[model samples]
Target: MTVNPLVLIAILLTTFTCRAERLFIGILEADSIQSIHYGAAAFSRISDLPLVQEQVQARLAQALLLPAYAGIAASETLKIVQSVDSDAPPAPDNPANVAIIPLTDDGTMIRQAFAAAYARHKSQDAFTLYEAPSDTNRAPCVAVAVADRHLFTSVSRPALTWAWQNRSKFLEAPAQSLPGTFRILVNPQRMADLTGARSAQAARIIDLGRLLRACEALSFSFTLEGAALAVTLRATAKQGSALDALLASWRVPSEPLWHAVPDNAFFMSLGAADRPDLWTPFLGAQRHRLLVPTSGRLPPPAVTGDRLDYVAPTRDGKGLCWVQLLPVKDPAAARAAIRMLADAGCTNAVTFSRLRRRQAGATAIETYTVTLQPPQMAQADKTPADPSLGHILLSLLLKRAVLECAVHNGHCVTVIGPEGAIDEHLPPETFAARPLPLNRRIGGQDPALTPDLSFGGFLCAADLVRHTVTIMPEIKPEQARLLPRGGDGATFGIVHNGRTLTASLRVQSNEIAALQRLNREGRAVLQEVFFQIFANQMMDSKRPAAQ
Candidate 1:
């Protein structure tokens, strides 16, 4: 008997009456896993690097969850149903996951396989249970059962029985055929609610709840052709929701500003804007804090055009610097905004002093120095100021902070760097002299890919690791272990095709290891950074007050 894929999907779409009961359904059509294998095998055969080939094999085997997965025949059709906790956030370490995998041959093959792996077996509550005592005590009592042509596994017997009993609810009469090789649909609102509850302050600060409320469902799909794998993530908007309105208003196409970025730049994010008001969605309220860092409430500069943001290493490759370019619609308004930012600096415990003015080709650049003032101490604790001491402290903290602002070719170009490393990558002339094509750099050049995507960015993985370790030497060893090496880069693009918004991540076959490593270590990297910052703050608090 053959099952209609759409019937299974319809069952997945059904709403549960219990608030705590959550379900996740995944459908893998025939040959899906085989295709992934084929891609990896083709890559391995073509790749010149032997280590990358070995890495692909190891990753594929681990993902399949069996040592001899390479020899296992691909299932004709695979349906996976898991029960999730709606109140709790999803996590990798969640041990409550119950999986129901459809089986072939009356489930006898899988039953025998489980029995061989476990030490005890018995029949209880109309379900055969197999127990595996974990050697490490991570899962002392694991359970597995084979019933109704499906294999169930879970740490909890209650969860297993619940899934077995409600298994019928996830299927119906035959209907339409499945569309993609692999697809998964999730309830975005439920996930959003859990996230909001967990991070109430952060959710409120960014209005994350409201923004995610418009998404009725979030979907992911994957397709592999030859050696290239394309993964797309899309959020289905609710009818008449705030996100619906926002998406409708986002009609501006991101312009091509890849040529503006220097080849040595480690990262780049470029987009286009028709007017200043449209930037709110991309920048949000945090733009002011990032761009100006002033305590004033003055409006942002009136600018509208293509945006080019890039980060590159300093001349000696010891430090990193950033540059931002925005189209200058009104130079006078831009100047006034800068002045307001400078004037508001004093209120924010910082000072902005004009250093000098110089000519860089046809553009006139005005440079400034931003210095962070030391905290004040009580009168009794105050001591005579030592000029050398203050100078050393400032140099160590600010590292010769420099900011250069210029308007060239109808764009407000701002470059911020340390140690006077700002003159090498000046806008217009320098960029024109050495233009870096983004598509060529990342191997993402495709004529079919829309040139006017809503947003696009690139990350040079090797450069990122180098620059990150260079900046924070304390984490060099740990970062080396966490980050992937020997990959060119990865590219991400987002497209809004009138009705739906789709974000895609594309990478070359050689960079597969890097992508996998990044996925595994990305969270660890963030945690390490936060821990370092907290440690530094605690040390500073313990230090004696500067005189």
Candidate 2:
């Protein structure tokens, strides 16, 4: 009896739905396992970006050391899931997570990739041969699984059993919702325990136990949104008074100074007033004690009541600059502080004769220009040292640094850089004509992303790459070609909201193909750079001990 087409379609749909549940149920089972420690699952739709797909395919081929993969066209959708078993004892055979990749073409390419991987292991006396059954249905399926120890005995066996028993599972819907191009979830507590147990001695140095106890979990997701790559990190904090104290110490009032930054700056960071006491820990007690003196000819106070801090470096590295804005609570006090700093050799030349005093509304304003002398060469022997040699050459090449300060309207604006660089770029008219203020730029983009206070900065990738290549002429032409050319610079910032802290970084490019290619190849370099930057910031902001 021939079945009606409509009825057949409905039957197929219901069967597929049931099979999908079974697949998801297996995942749930694995997640519930008492010994199971941590796992991550990611799904990617490469078909959306054909160029990216091709690039990934090329990299995978190289990684697998299989030429066949180079010609293979990856499936439109790919999913990878992995888990670890913490309780498993140290042995050759230990259970771990498996990776499931469904392909559109026959499973030949997958088989080749695994075979090549196995051959490499065999050459090193680490290979284990296992005869495994294959699913030879109309659309063949291939599974490549890995374990903490023995791949075939621990991870592959269990994975194959699941695939065989529920053949329809791989053919049905995915096990979970796919949120982004890449996603990761980590159990901080468990990971800490595992790491600490492996190196008990090292744990004493860093105290991982305390940190793990303070953090509940961490989740990270990355996606391509419009012209930018957006990354979001959510960290759950443990409830307690310690967390409260930490959050309270982070709360401070400040304004962003993006408008004051020069257009030629290769990189810049600006943020509102920071507590000088917060930086004492990183500077240490000895340095702190020396910073503030308690005798005649006293040095300026360690904390200058700076309301805003700005730093930038020029593209050619010829100019390094720092700017501090101090709100003048008392005119006499402000003037005394500046004079004290000047007397302590803060500037090479201080000309009180050129000082200008003005008024903005009822507020008093004073502007001063200070010159910093270049380094002097040490006393030469009886025979005068050549001007082309040593410190003499450096001093001759270096221009005298300059510091310009303008105190007005209850605020003091200080800028340090090459002579006249700051004054020429940051004139009153130009500063006032800037289109968007820092706070508005951040809030207007996404209100939810705004934090109590933030430090904003940008770096031009093309300029950075050009400088790097110039310094390292030995870099291969191919590698240099891979670097991104002209594109929108990358922007980064740190935000704090009560107990939570968020860091955001964004890079945009009109050359999407080149940018994606760079991301695929240089992900490790990018990650290392980001980690260093974040770690340095954290160290720099370390709080002082309460007396």
Candidate 3:
């Protein structure tokens, strides 16, 4: 029997898997990434695009190889392997990362390149090692083995030598390759152990180690198909991890909340929760400007419903607007819940005042606004207020902040936006109105698999960045220029089974190209924002505490 070449390649690629003991392994198909690079450039209409293969080869050579060595044909697949000792994590002194590249040619160019670049070399039966520059104390930074048809490189000489000895095992190991242009496999158990060995300071901010402990493994892949660039992320939970327990607690909705989404919405997230009360405090706190849910000051609102949140651009195109939709068992109870939440929000520090109440069709809509109250003092004692007070006053005068609520079509709608923007997001007369096309696709059926929790959405990356820059003019011109631009937007879907969660995102080719450029050149461009945030935190920490 004869097999097609594409089918044969797929079979071979699918059969390759990493060793069970390895902490992390990444296998990338060079051809696919190269194609994505070329596709992005073409989509962006760039006349001159650098050869990505040459760039890869140059980086691998580490400033040693001359430009001529870059002419060598690149390999089809590249493997990055990192393993950690179960008892002690790998550190800089005992580094355990190695890059394995199969040779398409005899690799004479690589040997010649190293010979021309370095003064010292050591020959071995298995591979030829090239010593680092004389100025550097490190030796045997790279290894080349033409006989074995592979090139191994690592910062640690022992790692490179070990990889050379174990090249056959790595080549023959079974790999679970995802369906994409690139693939990554991570053993989270090992990662969690590694994190435990590190300092515990990060846990105070966000316990990432705890999250990692709840996962068995993770896989990620990226594919450039037709005009779209798709990314797939999959994670498997440990047998009795926290994620497993949470997954068990969730009950899949019999009917998706597609009807709640508006057709014009650019972003929407719809999900079902068996315990609707768990979200009540969060929703209420999000509305109240002063009360923080995590601070344990605000009480949970008595809102009994499954929730969905969406953001839509205002009809006038001046700014963005948002709506929180809750389809509840009792609309009157939801109204009462909102009223209670508003009451809880009003305190000596801030004032939440009722602005208006009116009837629209069969629905009764109410509006409220929040503002900071002036400090308590005698009217005769006139004193200058803080400079920040002017900004608050300006915001109130602009009518850009508002909270409105209504009950329509068996749903309680909470609108948070500018003064007139609430009217635009009022619940329609019917729930089964036209939903976004992306929502229809995500809510559609696939008999192959069942999901406990599912979500779908789309984003116009260019438009979002533009709007952000417009709203916040403080963004530097250089930083704004580094942002993504000019794409047909992207769509994504996510589904979680009892033990696993999978998400896939697809973006236009132009957007993918812009992302690639950003990854390469935008890191330095965006560091200013992080610096400013850190500076602000430092200032806050240094401030004197209240008496």
For this target, which candidate reaches the highest TM-score against the unseen true structure? 3
Ranking by lDDT: 1, 3, 2
Tens digits of per-residue lDDT for model 1, 1-547: 4333333444555544343464443322323455555655565544333454467556443333321222233553344444555455566523244544445557666666655556777878657665663333324444665566655566666556656666666333232232233455545655565566655666323666666666765656555444445566666566776566656655443333566776688788876534435324423332223344321432344566556778888778666777787766687666565555455555434566778778766666777777755544447869533234444434343544677776676666677777355566655533443344553433345322455566677777655754555476556665656555646566777666554566667655556655555656665775676576566655755699889
lDDT for predicted candidate 3 compared with the true structure: 0.54
User: For model 2, how many clashes?
Assistant: 2
Q: Indicate the worst ten consecutive residues by lDDT in candidate 3.
A: 291-300
The parts of candidate 2 lying over 4 Å away from their true place are 1-97, 100-180, 190-213, 224-226, 241-246, 249-258, 272-320, 326-409, 412-414, 419-433, 438-453, 461-486, 510-547
Clashing pairs in 2: 254-272, 255-272
Cα lDDT for residue 49, model 3? Answer: 29
Span of ten consecutive residues with least summed lDDT in model 2: 34-43
- Of 1 and 2, which scores higher on TM-score? 1
